[model samples]
Target: MAEMKSGYIDYKGFKTYYEIYGERKDNGKKPLLILHGGPGDTHLYLLNYRDMADLYDRQIIFYDQIGCGKSNIPHQEDDFYDYDLWINEFFTVRDALGLDDFHLFGNSWGGMLATMCMLRDDTGVASMVVNGSPYNCQTWLSEANRLILYLPEEMQKAIAEAEAAGGDYSTPEREAAYMEYYRRHVVGCDPWPDFVQEAFKPENVGECFNVMQGASEFVMTGKMKDFNVLDQVKNLKVPTMLLSGTNDEATPFLIKEAYDAMPAGTEWVLVQGAAHIGNATHAKEYFEAVENFIERHE
Candidate 1:
């Protein structure tokens, strides 16, 4: 196994931590940056990418965003956490690591951020893979609510009632109700992974998510309330690919809408028998699809 090294980039005075796995090779493979989901998720969930060094002979960078994981936790909503803040942080980390041009992979929220970076036109992002992510938060939220209704009537009612009353999202009852739906639509047909469980910091997560995203998957009550990248999707100037699972909260309809809106030189694929966390649920198949996407662009 190759050694993994850690470092931090000072992005506009905020320190952002990142890790580099394996040695750089002249295999002509563009370095790959893996972005984890969540306005609060750490890069720990993406540790699996460390092994890809052997398969692809490219640098894989993993980092925890501010207020999440092994990174700096800034409680100030005013300065630290925002869409543009994160986008700039990505470029800061990439430039510090000397990644001139690279392939990008992001899951869920991370996928959305990756797309935002690609749209900047300043960053020389070579290609991208957005797995199980939607282009517009509003459209995706509607799909999530519809999927939640498919559960047992009792479970559906429990969720609706709690949200109506503004129940605490950190409570055991709410967690149980949400987890039931999350299992089927978020991760799909399996028990929650250990890392996924570890990543659930209810207190901090609730504040961060609610402030930036919303109250529920269906609720759009945050700074990103009107976040619609639909108009800009067609302006994507890089080789891009989209991935979604059949049971993904990022429904096929939403994915197709984004795909259809993209400029030419893009592709979309559905990972069979997987859901939102397709990369984890079906590692080999997911990685193979990603590998093909990167190779095709390279």
Candidate 2:
């Protein structure tokens, strides 16, 4: 039987909650740490990954980053919610866990943060899995706009009108439009898994997202308006794998851009018929791909 433990860490005055499944003892395989999306989606949705320990025999770790889930959210200026802060937080988690070497799985915003962390330090990471994420917000926004065109005419018109009227993404019409896009390109699953639903809770939509990534997935009027690391990713030599859905908001083509920019041997997995959050609906395929990639790299 795998062991399970949970705890909190004092990270720069805030409490960051983490959970570990499987023993961390020398088991020939390195542990895996997961980073969930939304910048505030907590680690609940990703709890599905616990099976990695049971099925693959590798330790699995999950942490609800500060400002979400069980972690304490600090009341600071909007400026506090930036890549530098999140990057430092990532290192703190690693240091606290004593994870000298491990695999990483990052979804959506988490994937972007993982890429950023890799750019800062790749020596200790055996390999990384970036899921439904982008390296550039500008490109992501552009792609989202393109995807918006495929929505119904009413949705397209509502989106255009909302943007023209100061980008009100909260209107009922606007929200419906967003949901239509989400249903088709985000989760794509009829009844969202409970974990995915947990990620959509109000508290999960915290300042990190509000200040850093704007109100909607399709907009970019936040501090990360110019976030882009495509130019520098070529410097990374880490064995990496990029995972995306066939119809993900992250887009297969954009994922290809990052793949092309990575080291020569970087891997890519495209989940057929899945959307943004493949793990939410296609766990068997998504988790296996991750397991296979990490197993080989490890």
Give the winner by TM-score.
Answer: 2
lDDT of 2 by residue, 139-174 (tens): 889999999999889999988887787668778998
Best by lDDT: 2
Lowest lDDT 10-residue stretch of candidate 2: 203-212
TM accuracy, model 1 = 0.92
| TM-scores, all models, native as reference | 0.92, 0.94
RMSD after CA superposition, every candidate: 2.0, 1.7
Show model 2 residue runs off by greater than 4 Å: 1-3, 164-172
lDDT for model 1 comes to: 0.78
Candidate models: Cα lDDT each:
0.78, 0.85
- lDDT tens readout by residue for model 1, 235-276: 888888998888788889999988888888789988777878
